[model samples]
Target: MIIPILYTFYLSFFDWNLIAPTKEFVGLKNYIEVFTDPVNQKVILNTLIYIIFLVILNFVIPYFISLIVKFFISKMQGTYKVLFFIPSLFSLVVGAMIFTWILNPVSGPLAYILKAIGLTMPNWSNSGILAITVICLITNWKVFGYNFILLLTGLGSIPKNIIDAARIDGIPKWRLVWNVILPMNRGIAIYVLILTIVQGLQYVFTPINVITTGGPYYGSSNVIYQTYLNAFVLYKTGTSSALAITTFLIFLILLFLEIKFVESRDKDYV
Candidate 1:
């Protein structure tokens, strides 16, 4: 893995073509070209946008949703837990397909409501930016239930006695959660943050492939999509390899930041 990764990084320094049967060692030229190219610039910006939405949807929204689920589940029992987890069982393909049908302008229930209300429902899959945002939304909806399960486990790890003591001390609900519950579950918080970032990046490929295919003027095409287009569509091996290396580096940097954040939070836990 390291060899291939390193080789790609090395290849990024060259202007090589697979068809020409010639390899040109153009150090930093490819990297410079990638930065200067308008299409490449758009791809990079779109990728960063995707990452921002992915982190917020996959981490922040799910975290809050899980908290809500756990809070409600405290008074409920087994059946509710199973019901809440139903979405977790759904595959991404299935979820995306379901949402696509539901978003259909002519026949979907949502569209019908919008039409009744004298409003327009845009064709999300056809619009590049809209498609990308919808992809993130679907990803959030699909994975939220599983995130809830993870958070439920974290919530369960907290000792009930401490919470009861806080309640008895006349602490407000938010204060109890912030001061008592969150501090105790710092490990869980960090674990969730790291896992969410990793998972969000990993799954970004699915929506781009399934829904947009980097269409509607490359609006939804992220770095992964651009790499795929270069390697598979255009058969530009060197360029794709360069893109892969840059993407890996960017991913590593993001991962490192998350690791540092986790480490900083861990100090409180200790």
Candidate 2:
């Protein structure tokens, strides 16, 4: 696996078609072209915006949801956890397909409900930012339950003694969470951040391919979609490899920053 990835980096620098008689070295042309190409620029910007949205949805929203679920979980048996977590068990493809139907312009449940209320809903995959935002919304909804479960497990690790100490110290509920629970769970936060960011990059692809297919004028396509389109649709293997390599580099940098942040925070925790 590592060798293949390393080879991708080497191949990305060249203009080598898979069927060509001679592989030609193009230096940094592919990388340079990535930045200069209008479509590639749009994909990169769209991907960055998607990442920002997902980080908030995956890490921040899930943490609060877990806090809410924790309150209920303490009073009940494990039944509530099971019920809330059922969605996480379904395949991403299945979940995206289901949501696509719900968001369909004509026959979707949401559209039907809006019509009944004397409202007209625009097509979800409409031109411009609306398409990308809809894709982000669907991605967030599908991954939210699983993230909540992760945070719930982290919450469960908090000691009863600590909660009692905070209570005895006259700490307010919000203050207790802010000053105690959040700091104590910082490691979990960093872990979730890294995992979510990495997975978030790849997870948007299913929805983009299925719901939009880069439709409504390529509004929702990300780097991964571009790579797929290049390789399979356009048969531009060299350019596809370039896009793939760029995706890998972007994620690698993100992973590195996350590791550095996590290690620094761990020292502070120590």
The most accurate candidate by lDDT is 2
lDDT of 2 by residue, 55-105 (tens): 888888888878766653466526756776777777778878888788787
Model 1 segments beyond 4 Å from truth?
77-81, 257-270
Per-residue lDDT tens digits for candidate 1, residues 92-174, read 78877788788887889899999999998998878767888888887777666666667778888788888888889999888
Q: What are the clash counts of all predictions, listed in order?
A: 0, 0
- Would you list the clashing residue pairs of candidate 1? none
Which candidate has the top score in TM-score?
2
